[model samples]
Target: MTVKSKKYHISGERLEELQQIAEENMFMHASQLNDWRGKLNIFVKGEGVWVEDAKGKKYLDSLGGLWYKAAGYGRKEIADAVYNQMTQIESSPSGSATISQIELAGKIANLYPEKSSRSFFVSGGAEAVETAVKMAKKFSILNGKPGAYKVLSRRYSYHGGTAMAVSLGGAKTADPMGPTMPGAIHVTNWNSYRLPYSGDPVDVAIKCANEFEEVIKHQGPDTVAAIIAEPVSAAFGIQIPPQEYWQRLREIADKYDVLLIADEVITGFGRLGEYFGPMNWGVQPDITTVAKALTSGYAPLGAAIATKKVADAFTGGPEETFTHLITFGGHPSACAAALANLEIFEKEDLVGNSKKMGNYLFEKLLELKKYDIVGDVRGGLGLLAAVEFVADKKEKVAFPASAKLAQKLPKFLFDRNIVTFRAGDIISICPPLSITKNEIDYLVDAIEDSIIHLKKDLNT
Candidate 1:
């Protein structure tokens, strides 16, 4: 699994210029750009599962450009669609309707559950989450439950980065951003790898579901607007709950007369072997938020889809407008790109490929458990998976936070011309759906090599 590095050159002056611009103006997200400074590797191009840095070094992008890129990279069809749409209509007012937007909405609505036939466009996943939250609150009020404003989310769930989305997120990512939006309640997450209770998986799931019911009861069910959750909690280490878990959650939400919002930003648009995660789990959420793979990372676009009943709530007089709106909610070019991306998905049967390739990748990843440092390999049914490292496999003891394996492992893989993501001690491998069997082998080999190297370096 050796990575062949190619020698390429970029003008030193051009590199310095880019560095100067970044240092002077660019405020990076979730990054210490200042520390990176001039040493940062700038990717200039991408094709399929690979991206090339300015230095012409190619790296296999296992994370699929932050868990997007379902159609892989460098798709001329998507680009041409965007270009054609831009030429016809560069921009339209938020309130104004466009053909591309309407068509995209129809396509997405048809893919969703039968009840979910309405779509509200947004720029990205965070915006989609924000839109879903707003719709939930509005729907509650419209339905005569004005007190239903609280949203229940699972602990360690990652929604988005916007203030409202961050508040809805159960992770500690927004701790430093000051107090979260009021009424954002947190409950236990379903991470079997680090289960709080030692018992049968079903029993633990029931207990977790009971916790949700308890929270709703405590909060007063009438005051709860929605229970938002990711079908497969990707940010919390790809925690795939049992099928019973989702069924129970659906029942609980129904019992409390609360809307269920599935934040499918990661698992939507064929990432999880199905059209959507809810379909995969056989639970139909009242509202589903989608982004990322919607346009396959070729453009920024997201959608907040609602059941017909929910959408009908806002269809009254002129004054009954859904007040929540973004200036670029349904940019025509983005919608065109999304439509073209979906076309590729249909033509190439990428969803089917995701299911097949995902199973193969999962099987290969399990081989990593042979290593002493590889604590767990969790994933299947989709093109998403993670490898959790441990200091003691027998006791399931995790490495100290100071070890910084999460930060170090990605770098080690990057140096070897392989790109992946690390969350805490877990390394997430989510390649494009188009990735082949040989690429999966390459990815797993790189991961194993990096872990072995780190073990010796840390003398673990």
Candidate 2:
């Protein structure tokens, strides 16, 4: 809690030099085709829950550095851990495992729902998801159903950017990329805010869940490998499902002999106050994909933690060795950083803090309902949250795409010196689990100011 971001400012000449590099050398991701390269806000340093831009201006990092940073920033322990690991051994081949990888795998397994689960490391979340889907298909093959390679995913949920991950997640990011991966079936995703049908909340939830069973039946369960989804969808408004929903999915998966995968990349490592997000509802998935907080952004790392049942499928015969491989799947330095980051979590009891603060945050968010632009505020899990904007709250109508309501609101918040990102019509508010109430207040206040200004802009 005492950690503070160090002041950082580049000289005018240095700043201009960096701007030139941005305009030419650096190709940004999901950006305006290098149109505004020099206009980028270059963040130079970070510590605790704050980040400093090149101009020496510090802002509270409200999105937890892309929903990781469970232990926050500028931890010397993490840096030292990585340094020591690199000096000892920097990398490992996919076929082989390093001491760090072996140790880290055990530590990761202990945190999973089934403590005896096995971990298969990857570079990050996208790869983790890609790996999970493949694991399910492989399991299907083990069950003598090589034809069962199809995966079922919720329409609005986000998995990652790889072909398989994109295929599993039908979020907006997958739209412009053209066709989804073959055999990926997108199904109905439920949102409590805007029900697709009118009925009792519990009954309606069951109806939505039944839609998946229907998909499995229609697609032929024999041809289906797995049903995949984020325990709580992040990019699509933090869509939280009811207990009944997960229960139904589990039951259907069991009845149909289909594997269940929980894409826990954004919700893992105590993001939802629970060690694993799905634990909130007592749903133990066959495979859990994770990343982001695995190394808390200090090092790129991810893993598919498979339950003993799923892992045992690959343990037979010389040919059954789970043939999937990533060249740099379990880098030693990354494993070391992940181990250290997790140590910080235990030392600080960040998970307990998340539960306490998450409750307080949701209670406070109710106040945003007073504003016309605030249509829905959704989050019950730890730090993950979203505020969906609407032009007509009563009717739950969204601001037109032409208005770019989601885009401009974050810009206004930038002016107020807060850092966050918008996912379509909603703005994410996932700060570090280490965040204090005062920091949350600062973020919410900036959001309020941004909303007020945005309303004015729309009216004008």
Worst 10-residue lDDT window, candidate 1: 1-10
For 68-118, candidate 1 gives per-residue lDDT tens digits of 989999999999999999998888764578799989998997777763589
Scored by Cα lDDT, where does model 2 land? 0.85
Model 1, CA-based lDDT: 0.87
Error of 1 at 413 (Å): 0.5
Clashing pairs in 1: none
Give the clash count for each candidate. Answer: 0, 0
Report the lDDT of model 2 for residue 256: 93
lDDT against the true structure, per candidate, is: 0.87, 0.85
- Give per-model TM-scores: 0.95, 0.95
